[model samples]
Target: MEKRRIQIFDTSLRDGEQVPGCKLNAKEKVKIAKKLEELGVDVIEAGFPISSPGDYESVQEISKNISHTTVCALSRAMEKDIKIAGESLKYAKYPRIHTGIGTSNVHIRYKFNSTLDKIIDQSMEAVKYAKKFVEDVEFYAEDAGRTDNQFLSKICENVIKCGATVINIPDTTGCCLPEEYGKKIQFLMENVKGIHKVVISTHCHDDLGLSTANSLYGIINGAQQVECTINGIGERAGNTSLEEIVMIIKQNPHLNFFTNIKTQCFADISRLVSKYTGMKIPANKAIVGINAFSHSSGIHQDGVIKKKETYESINPKDVGVNDSSIILTARSGRAALKYRYQQIGYFLKKNSLDLVYSIFLKYADRKKEITDKDLETILEKANLIKNHSSRLSSDISRHVI
Candidate 1:
């Protein structure tokens, strides 16, 4: 079966930068834009041009440097915001103007203190004005997660009629369950007129820790584009994670959804974003996390030692990680201990193994885990192993074979 391609619309620069204390300058923005281009994102939302002169310059600079990737600038429903966004992308080879307004009742009644009619009118006007400046215009209905499905359909229909190349339904507050969000997308696909004419995109937040799940469900329902940030950095709890979304689609071929992202660049891009943004990735975080492919349990280590597929769903090399780790901790089993010993060139016989295990538990209790050097010390004290460094060299050579 032919697979459907999902456009990865990365908002790391625009939305991701909204994380408190995680700001990037124009140079850094351009740097990340270049990497995103290399990573093969379909679109990079540069910044909100009308928000500040610095943002405008950053968008302009990113537009100037990015060649293949579409450089997108965000704007509000106002004319000034749309015009400034357009000017900021003058040098972009593939420029898109992303402009929209709040569509939820809460936003209309309280945020804007206006009626639904005015909000709909503002949305239509914004898309129409943006269409004049750029051929590729993406309209986002902020807080669409909480908007009424019927009213949201009307707003989407009007925006599409007004010339929006893409319609973004964002879970601005990160307040919807996966099933609810999926149903919302399905409703838009069925009820919105001209829905098939433009791409339906999903921009989800992780406030409820459902951003990735919500995005996946949106695709299954109808969305063809995913708006995500590297390492899930964004406002509040952050946006959908790019690595998680891409890996999910890749690992599950039956879904038949694909993105142009080079999966091998996952680790590199995650590290770069973490370094520049100063947000250290959690060790247990999925995909790019340090312990994503590590094992410590005895049963798990035995299974993995016999066959990696026993415990691992995805290979380490698939996402550019060098190798899977066999972490030796107090919880680890004898199988893991044996594997660690063999890895460093200490081969213990079954009779000697019980003795070594007894000593290992003592040391393990004293230390949080065992290291290669610790193993060597254990072997030396046992007086059963010789020439640790020479044996290690031979074991390394044997591994290469």
Candidate 2:
């Protein structure tokens, strides 16, 4: 089967920066953009030029430095916003103007306070005006997750007709389930008149903690591009995490899609964003998290000790992570304990394990984790006792401290 290639549009510098305290300086933004380019993103949505003067400079500086990835500037449907976006990317070799407005009735009525007809007209004008600046124009419909399927389809159709090279459907609120979001993409693929003229893209949020799932679903359905941020940092919960989305498609064969991302760079990118943004990644975060591949339970640890493939779905090396952690705790099995002991040069046999039980009890009483160093010290004392007279019996009964 032929695998479809999905364009990864990294929004780490733009939407990811919108998160509180995640604001990066122009220097930081340029630094990240260079890394994003090295990570092989198809496009880097640098910043919203009209949002602030700082944003404009950051986008411009990023555009000047980035050579391979297409530099994109976000803008509202207003002419001023699109103009600022174009001005910001004047030096970009491959520039794209990503401009759009809300297409959902809720946004049309409550947010924009305008009629649907006016919404379509304004969206078209934005795309057309943006075309004057750059050949690549991407149109986005915010809150596309909750938008009426038929109306959203029309917005995509007209946006493409107006010269949008790509149509971005954003689940801005992360409100939809995976199945519903998938169906929504399928609907756009089946209904939009001009859908074939432009690539369909997905920009899903993680408010409900399913951004990566929904984005993958979009790819599985029909979305040819995915808008994501490093470490999943963005407004609210976040946009689709670039690491999560990339790992998912790589690990799941059923998705039938591929991207150009350098998967091995995933960890470094996550760490860089987390450090710059000051938002520490959750230990349970997919792919790049510290505990993503950690095993502690007895059954799982035993399986992992037997073979890493038994417990881990993806290889740590693939995503630049060091290795799976075989954490030792009360739930750890003898096999894991033996494996850990061997790591410290202690090859304990069954009889030796019986002797070690008393030491284990003492160690468990005082500490939650029995470090190899601690185990070695305990054994060293035991070996001294064996030489003294008794065969390292619990006669001395020193605490496992």
Candidate 3:
């Protein structure tokens, strides 16, 4: 089967910067934009230009320099925002205007104080207005997760008629489960007229910790694009983490899906975003987390040391992680201890290994780990008692822990 390639629309620079204290200057945004292109994202959403002068400058500068990926600028349904989005992305060889208004009842009634009919009309007008500036106009009906499915289909139909090349159905509040979100996509696929005219996209929030699941569901049902940020960091509960979604796609090979991402660049980009945004990557985060590749328990450690596939389903290297980690702790097997110890240049036979293993167990029980330094101390004492001091200590003094 010839599987359709999914378009990865990275909003790390735009939506990611929306989180408090995540403001990146124009220089930083351009630097990251280049990296996103190299990492193989199809579209780099630069910023909401009219939101602020800094944002506009970042969008314009990124559009000017980033040539590989289609540079995108976001906007509301208002003409000024769409105009600014268009202007900001104008310098790029490939530019797109992402503009739209709210679609849910709460957003229509409370946020905009507009009726459902007026909201649909406004959405169509926004898409038409955006089309004037660029051939590629993406219309996002914000809070589509909460909007009525039939009405949402109607709005998407109207927007497609108005020249929208892409229709963004966002779970703005992250209120819907995966099944419900899949149903929304299915409904649109079944109901929307001229559905093939535009790409179906999903932009989900992680308020309920289900954004990635919902996104996957959408893709399986009908969505062709996934809008996400790095490290699951964004407004409120954050959007889907780009690394998470990409890993999921890669892991589920039976689904016959693949992204254009360079898997080797995942960890490096995650670090850069974390450092720049001052949002530390949690140790337990899937794919890019510190412990994601570490094997700790004695049985698991032995199994992994013998063969990594015995314990881990996905290889760490597949997602750009450098190597599998073997920590010398109370739970660590003798195989892990021997391999880690040999790095400091100790060659022990089976009988000698038992002695060291006994000492390691004792040391491990006292401390959380039996570090290289502790091993050195143990070896030194045992050898000194035999009036034969070790030579490894002198060689490793400069690189002391």
Candidate 4:
């Protein structure tokens, strides 16, 4: 079967930077934008230009440097915001203006003090105005996760008719379950007029840790674009992780979904985002984490050492990692010990290994991890180094004779 290509719309420089204390300057934003283009992101959401002058400059800078991928600027459902966003993207070869308004009841009543009909009107106007500046216009229905499906369908259809090429359904609060989000997308696909004329995009948050799941479900239900950030950084809890969604679609061939993403650049971009943002990626983060491929359990290490596929579904090199690690811990067994020893050019006979294993256990119990230096110390303490050296000399002499 032909694989359906999912456009990866990266918002790392925009939404990802919304995390508290995680801000990037224009130069830093440009650096990341260039990297995102290299990583094969289909669209790069540069920034909300009306938010600040710094953001406008950043978006302009990214637009100037990025030529392959579409450079998108975010805007509210207001003429001023759309105008500024357009001005910021004047140099972009492929420019998109993302403008939208709240459609959910809570946003309609409290956020905007308006009614459903007015909200739809505002959404249509925003898309119409944004279309004047860029041929590619994406309209976002803020808080669409909680918006009534019927009303969501109405606004989405209206935006599409008003020249919007992409309709983004964002679970702004990150509250929707996978099934709920999937059904929501399905409802739009079945109900919205001209839905086939525009791409349905999924913009999910991770407040409930369901962003990635919801995005995948959205795709299964007909969403062709996924809005995500590197390492999942964003407002509040976060957004769908770009690496997670990309790797998921790549690994699951039966899903028949593919993207233009360079999977090998995951680790590099992940590190760059973390470094610029000063947010330390948890060692347990999926895909690019430091410990994602590290094996510490004796059974797991032994199995992985015997066959990589025994414990790991992904080849470390596929994500730019050199190899899987056999970490020496208290739970490690003889096989892991032997493998680690061999890695450092030490060849221990079964008897010598058995002897060293006993001593290693005692040392392991006292420390969280056993280093290569500790292994050498254990060999010396066991008096096996001298004996092994003598044996080596004897073998050399016999061979010479």
Question: Each candidate: RMSD to true structure?
Answer: 2.5, 4.0, 3.2, 2.8
**Which of the two, 1 or 2, has more lDDT?**
1
Model 1 / residue 153 / CA error / Å: 1.1
Please report the TM-score between candidate 2 and the true structure. 0.93
For each candidate, the alpha-carbon lDDT, in order, equals 0.91, 0.87, 0.87, 0.92
Best by TM-score: 4
What is candidate 1's local distance difference test score?
0.91
Q: Which residue ranges in model 3 land beyond 4 Å of their true spot?
A: 381-401
Per-residue lDDT, model 4, residue 36, is 96
lDDT at residue 353 of model 2 (Cα atoms): 66
TM-score of each: 0.95, 0.93, 0.94, 0.96
RMSD of 4: 2.8
Better of 2 and 4 by TM-score: 4
How many clashing residue pairs appear in each of the predictions shown? 0, 0, 0, 0
Once superposed on the true structure, which residue ranges of model 1 sit more than 4 Å away at CA?
385-401
TM-score of 1: 0.95
lDDT tens digits, residue span 1-401, model 2:
89999899999988988887667999999998999999999999999999999999998999889888899999999999999999999999999999999988889999989998999999999999999999999999998998999888887888888899999989989999999999999999999887888898999998998898898889889889999999888998888989888888888777678889899998898898898889999999889889999998889999988899998999999999888988877777778877777775456767676676666657766788777667666676556344322344443333322
Which sections of candidate 2 miss by over 4 Å? 380-401
Expressed as tens digits, the lDDT of each residue in 1-401 for candidate 4 is 89999999999999999988888999999999999999999999999999999999999999999989999999999999999999999999999999999889999999999999889888888888988899999999999999999889988888888999999999999999999999999999999999999999999999999999999999999999999999999999999999999999999999999999988998999999999999889899999899999999999999998999999999888887888899999999999998888887777778778989999999999999999889878887777765434443221121221
Task: Name every residue pair that clashes in candidate 4.
Answer: none
Stretches of model 4 off by over 4 angstroms after superposition: 386-401
